[model samples]
Target: MLLRDRVALITGGTSGIGLSTAELFLREGARVAIVGRSEDKGKRALERLEVLGEVTFHRGDVSKEEDSERIVKEVVSRYGRIDILVNAAGVFTGAPLIEMSVEDWDRTIAVNLRGTFLMTKFSLPHMGEAIVNVSSTAGVSPYPNGTAYCSAKAAVIAFSKALALELAGRGIRVNVVAPGLTDTPMLRGIAGSEERMREFASLVPLGRIATPEEVAEAILFLASPKARYVTGQVLVVDGGMTAGRVTTAGSRAAVR
Candidate 1:
């Protein structure tokens, strides 16, 4: 067990990559606190996870400072201290710059960037081991309609790197897991249908989208002692999507 008897707080833990990480941590012997904004989802997650190990759900919107502070206090009250903090809560928005509304932009930044900041700020005092932030391949690669999401995710990567340096002396490690095109409720919402999601998968060199469990494995590695020397880095789990464009043998580009 990589995290035997440790405590972990995972935001966005009710679903997708966050939920998967919670399960993995529990199996690794960590008492887990899963945070989210949806009460219904939280309840369901607790019901599903309670059998696995010691697990609790803290429902709060991480984008708000007060909520983030309260959630951290609640976790600390139950667990005494935090060994891992995973900021995985996020929202996605896409539009051309001129057509994008202020509300959409603000909401995207609030949940993705500001939420990470608030959670890390409050968790730091109680946290002793690691912080793994969930970013996206979109952080480095640009797309036509992802201005707000791309900007917020890029900021998360930069913030993690800077904080890693600041907290190195304190024995705290901060790192990032930037996943590409994972199959999750959030991505499903964006894709609108399974067929559409498959279409999106074709864009990746791997010919398939990642499972949430795969991304969670990356998070688990960063949070565990296995990565004790690893800090201030971005681990991209994109299945060669960002490596380079894939060209078929029949294509003119492949001829060169």
Candidate 2:
């Protein structure tokens, strides 16, 4: 019961890592609320979460200021306080910089960076609690044809660090979790083919892609008392993908 009696609100909680985190939070005795744009998905997540604890669904787009403000208000009105906030709503569109239109850049930035900021802005007063932002390794490394997605994620990392410093005196901890090649619906969409997925998996040192639950576990640790003294840090959950350098000899060179 690490989070007993806590109140948590998770954006993009209808699927993937957000959904997994909501389930984990509820299992640990936290009352949870999930925000999503799809009513069906939100309802399904609510149903699943209700089995563990008091759970609610707030349908809204994270990129909208009105939606973020209204959802926070609703959660506060129902739960009295928000002990945790997970900014996990994001979008990924891959295209080279020259081909990426202003709309593509704006849309990605709006949902990933701007949405995180708006959610934090509205949830902070109610958060005498913790904030866990979901960033990505793409923010730190250059990914092919990922200008928009990379830029937004990089901005998220910076935003969380700056906000963590500003909110330190308020007893609020802010941190970012940068997951690499997680097996989420979004990732599947990007993979587009089984061959691509396999190629991507082969790049990971672990020889596999991380499940959404694995990422959720890391996030829960940061939000729990275990990380009480930790703040303004980025936790990378990649399977050593970014830790190694390219070798000319490939796998055979390791035998030497």
- Relative to the true structure, how large is the alpha-carbon lDDT of every model? 0.94, 0.92
lDDT of 1 at 38: 88
For residues 1-256, write the lDDT of model 2, one tens digit per residue.
9999999999999999999999999888999989999999988887788888899999998899999999999999999999989999999999888998999889999999999999999998888678999999999786899988998999999999999999999989999999999999999998999899999999898889999999999999888878999999999999988887746576568767
Error of 1 at 183 (Å): 0.9
- Worst-scoring 10-residue span by lDDT in model 1: 246-255
132-159: candidate 1 lDDT, tens digit per residue: 9999998988788899999999999999
TM-score of 2: 0.97
| Error of model 2, residue 19, in angstroms | 0.3
Show pairs that collide, candidate 2: none
Task: Give the C-alpha lDDT of model 2.
Answer: 0.92
Give lDDT for model 1.
Answer: 0.94
